[model samples]
Target: MTITRRDFLNGTALTIAAGLAPTSVLRAAEAQGPAYPPALTGLRGNHPGTFTLAHSLAREGAKYPGVLARESYDLVVVGGGIGGLAAAWFYQQRFGGNARILILDNHDDFGGHAKRNEFTVRGRTLVTYGGSAEMPPSANDNAAVRALLAGLDLAPRIQARPGDDYARRGLGRAVFFDAEHFGRDQWLAGDPFAALVDARNAGVRPAPEDLGAFLNAAPLPPADRQALQRLAQGETDYLSGMAGEARARYAQSTRYAVFLREKAGLGLPGLRFLRSRSQDAYALDADGITVAQAISIGLPAGAGMAAPAIDPRLGKSPASRLWFPDGNATLARALASKLVPGVAAAQGQEIVGARFDYSKLDREGNPVRIRLNSTAIAIEPDVRITRVTYGWQGNLQRVEAAHVVVAGYDMMVPFILPSLPVPAKAALRACVKAPLVYTKVALDNWRAFDALKTWRIHAPTMAYSDLWLESAPGGKDDPVVLHMLYVPTVPDSGMSARERFRAGRAFLLGTPFEVLERDIRAQLDRMLAAGGFKSARDIQGITVNRWAHGYSYMPSGLAPDDANLQVALEQAGRGVGNIRIAGADTAGSPSVTAAIEQSMRAVGSLNPKT
Candidate 1:
């Protein structure tokens, strides 16, 4: 009996309602002596309950029938992602811990994208972020985010020693050219960040000439190789006809693909090589993104020329030095623990090792209650109090609150609170998130990676853009998880950025898990065959945390008057009748820093005396 991704997502909702621990279920399955690649192991984010609830609220378009129970609170927050969790913490900060609050999230887990993917293989425990991995250093400057971490005693920083150690183990960067793009499966040992020399470790610099050799060795025809050679050199003035200011303007205004085709003469093959780079960073394709944005992130021939400040080798200081083992999930965990004491150990960043008592999350008489697998269906703001109707345990439940923070996905806000003003709704709709998929593939051993002489591989023409070996907390051999990132996008010749995102979201949600798994297995085998990697033989388990609607929208630099656009969004989210809007949407960016800021805004909108 094979369970599809959709089936598995739906199945988990039932399991959550039954109060069954997913860990116990996994242990029970492991007790059966591991069925090889294992049964039903894909699509792990936006769990079944969350998916169904959002779908029901959106597509169903009907009022939730017959309230199961009625409750009241001083504050009711919708969605339990980082933003909502922070909102709960902020309420505690502003109104004291005595404030009665309830956080309703559709997912079985409360961390939202801050969820975790834990696996135990051969008496070894391997943990990876299910979603919302890594915190930017700028987050440290965010007093709220920093204060929360401080309260939890979590000092977020990457253990560069482990990563450096891993790099020394016959490991480096590699690029994969799928047959669709390059006419054959080819892996080249080279650093993709060759142009931004400083981005690589201090001693791990690959010279331009060395990278040229790697490109020349690609299984491309002579002409293609020559074109690639020129691209690698970065000395070619490909904009020959358009010189000086014209060239500068062309570089800034022209789409990278056009610059590549018309100016650089990269042809179809050369362009394909650079296509994945854009999608991996922003969800935009070559056609959709401007050459300016492309250069800012580093790509094409003149990327470093335009953006010297981004060059890591030039001693350019990064925004911050804050990132955790499980990304921002650690922050989410910290916030949850603060809101619900004893839910997680009060220990520092090592909270990953602490087991959360979910049963205690929504215990009676607690000032703060986080109810998992509960979805907010509707919110009605009145003069005195806001009424929120949510679904929990397959029943519609109503909760009234003096203040309601609708801090879920921005797009869902209009649907959940239909009476919102038209302009605000339009502004909310514009906050569409970029869909992303992050997969963790556990392997029995990592000898294949060593044999291949690469730790990371980027596939421009495949479903997955890049994959690399993820390090566990403690350095050990034999068992490891290969983390792969997939941004579901295919260039639509005639679609706006938002339209393309919608199409990509549909494509991602509609696609089955088996297809994704097959691609993962096949791509791994093709890339690592030289090192003796057979997917079925060495693959232990795969957890695909599919966030069909991922990163929050931040207006493109090319977009007109970024300040005004944000002002419009902020005005739109000002909330009607105490139904204050919050989350990354109101922040006009998907960053955790913005989420925390919006959380403060949402709580601040109410009377401080309340």
Candidate 2:
């Protein structure tokens, strides 16, 4: 039976007042203080009241008559995401600091998917990322990305923290077998899947001896256990008879699951165990990933056959990547600070800890204003100026700009700009986003994790596939934040990647907060019960950052590359008169660097002679 919110609250020893709504819990705490977006826990990311107008315009064909144009700007950027923010910065740089620019976003907070979640437990403030978490080495390689980082006084590279804390505490990676799939609750101490990826990193190494014991302890049938043991041992070359080029071709064309079943000899149980391994990177299961793609990402294929090396362009070392306490939200905050002077008052890493003054974001006389909770409904381009109409407050507001940058979702662009060509609209509609959830649970203490002797747990069949502590607790009583990931992909469903993404998106938006909360609590309680973890007593706060339209979809390697689709994506990003498109989706890459690069390209396209 589905657990209700009342049942959950009644069962737990929650510190918050009874009957207080989850959405208002944080707001009530900040009644006497300045409103802070990061600290407002529960139902964030694509929060309610943020998407109503957009949904109405897209789904119901609702029209908003343009009100009298109340404001004019040199540039009006739709969507206050990284792309839009970067576009504003680039425009100001190109047109001088005096250029009047405005950025409009539907969400109450800026940064879009680059969201920051903050919590206060036991009088201590903790920071965690709700979305857009890492700056990989490839991001720094882009000159535009590097320039943006340099302007913010931020370093592209961060020194990896010395030593593995989990190892030091006698804890390691683990796998939790849920009753739904395994028929019983079982926790295995060592995870072979994680070790496969971790082995590629130079910073830490897993002991080879643990693999045998871990695999044997798994609740798999004897045949499945034997198959997994063979794959882990990496002694047999599944593609032994083929030449190098033929092997490469086969790997690219064949699915990873197909390879395991046909060549590696894995049965149903083994296939299920390995399904969600690829979800963290591609948001797809083993059935969706190509054998070549799987090997390149450090998934075990056949160690006997020279495994295809990780793409050098993507960067192989984990240490080369940089991250802030609140993920790439640091980059967003840095951009906002540069664009709007008083949004944040710190520099360098201090920016991560700085509390943003939301009031200063859209001041009367500011050259660059970021107006949040303003949803753009229409964008009509004229010979000179473009008329932009947005739903704000209780009425439709109009604004005119010399040039408009369409930096929001490519899919929504077709709805907003109905004047676009049929082909362009089709291309825009094709950019389906992968649906996922990044949940942050503020805990009273992480003694349970220490007791379990596992900092990370991978549960293939559970609601959340992956869960890990943001960092090791300093003491048994120290409060901590646990991060969880859920990707709603229907693998082996005979649907195309885009179709699966759309299905996942629908499922995410349809599921309520209470259901998500219940699943999280139940999963945690089941996984950590042996460690003396009780969700009611330990979980202090939960911020469910549901990205129904999450990661910008890219080809998942299950299907052959389509040239027509590539051309369509390119055409989608092309400028139409005074309107220029810029976003990760438009750029055809789901990275901060690509978004910034697209923004720069879009800005450069505007008024070239100037």
Candidate 3:
């Protein structure tokens, strides 16, 4: 079911010798190039060896032929993401400071989604967050998240300030409608949150008339234009039949797409336009989310309706003042320093600029060891200990731990530990994550963005949903990194949540790097042509951080309740023998805070029979 690079190369040799190879493959074979570095420019996620081990377990119910080596530890964590790292840290704090702990990850590097993508262009160092962009101040209120920040000596107030030119150079918000999706590719400049009347709102400087002009000029049918205009002007009576309270309740319980079609009387074009806005946060279309969920995330308030009021407690909470160039990778690095002393430079200083030596991660005799490029294939929990079998360095290895935490994808739990009860397996299987691709592009200079007079552009129909200049503590014309966020949702599939996630994951992994690079360049060329930007000319380097299993599935909208989902999840997470669960998936919310909270719970639930 899976073909790896090794397999492909082996087949390539036979085909070329038999004179049956394709021209492209032959040329690639004959091309004398630098040893191909898959890490440098292409194919970043569901990485070749990473998922093949999991697939062997899931698809074929495989068991390793023999264990080449065996080791024992006090605690073993099966992921190196924020959640897994924090679990080790919490275990150290709670029960044993000197416990022999080991963290294994499938990636060559740690900090799974909290990845720091680095680039050196024009002799200047630049970094961008590949995933996990920002941590809201509200999230830090959780004890676990706050404790982790405190451990890193990152006070909530010590933060990066945007350069003076940021406000001046930044494009507040703009929408681009592509010719394929709409009738034509049209770029319009406007603020998404400008129309609503609210005291808390920081209204756009553009006058109401200017905002109206942007909508009126959209290349839509007469009826669509009229409907948009009415919504924009705040003069629509779409909810005429219901009282104010009833209307509000309907909005909360019903999907926005349904509300638009049934109540707002908008056609497909209008629906598409409104739904595009949701891509900014949920990576979902209007039908995939409820109006309440949309409003909660500040997507859009319905036209002619007053914006919903924020919870007073949340409104009054402190805003996040700390932002590293690499987002929360700083937190992960700080935690790594605590777990393995010499792996990362000690924190309390400017942790963002700290140096990490990956080679020192698994030094001999260290109380806490981090083994990279190790994939957990199976986990079996016994009365006295939990045994984990993993593939490492071309061989199957085994490790026994008094307590084991499976901290990666929740759905894979059933596959990893086949003995899990039926209800527990079903509950773990129900949790599916959204697929995301975050591409960091190096540019010689940001002259194109300046020419376009916008720092960010939202494109729903393009391969990338949105493109924005990576925020740094510098000026606009400086060599900068542009971030393109792509959500490859299989739109109009009419598939269930699990099916859609599987399809999206398959598409994300199967699509090669060359295809992705071509698509990204094409999108950039199409969007920036008006500003005299050329992709090949301006673009210097590209790093695609493909995350097939990104963003945990959180229940929202008018979705029907799976009556037993929560109960089953709770039961599954209650440590089976010496094995437990950790991750954002266990928290049922996709966030760093949730990951930390779940880690704490997982560690606390560990009742080691040993």
- Stretch of 10 with least lDDT, candidate 3: 29-38
TM-score per prediction, in order, is 0.86, 0.90, 0.86
Model 1 spans > 4 angstroms off: 1-41, 66-69, 161-163, 192-206, 222-224, 236-253, 300-305, 308-322, 472-477, 492-494, 557-564
Per-candidate RMSD, Å:
6.8, 6.4, 6.7
Error of 2 at 73 (Å): 0.5
What clash count goes with each model?
A: 5, 0, 1
The order by descending lDDT is 2, 1, 3
What lDDT score belongs to each candidate, Candidate 1 first? 0.68, 0.77, 0.68
- Candidates 1 and 3: which is better by TM-score? 3
Question: Per-residue lDDT tens digits of candidate 3, residues 1-610?
Answer: 1223333334323211122222222222221111212225555544545665665566545555545337888999999988999999988877778999989988766777787777777788777677775665566578887787776677654445332345565545567887776899998765442333222233333244664566677766778766655555555667776788887777767777777777667787777777655554565667666666655544444444555433221211123333666776777777888788876565755667776777778877898988877778788877787788876665667988888988888988888788888878888888887777888898877776777677778775567876877664455556788888887655543334555556556667667788889988988888888888898888888989888888776654354654556566778887577788888777666677778888888998877434
**lDDT computed for candidate 3:** 0.68
In order of TM-score, best first, we have: 2, 3, 1
How well is each residue in 1-610 modelled by candidate 1, as lDDT tens digits? 1122444344323322123332232222221111121123566685333565565445544444545337899899998988899888888888888999999887667677776777777887776777776555456667777776766677766645234657766577788777766888777886544434334323233356666676677766666567766765566866556657776666555677777777777777777776667664566667666776666555545423454223211101232232666667777777878788887765576676666666788889999998877767788877788889876665567988988888888888888888988988888878878778888898888888878777778777777777878764343357988888887654525344665566566666666788878888987888889888899999988988888778777665344444366777888778887778998877766567777778888887776444
Pick the lDDT winner: 2
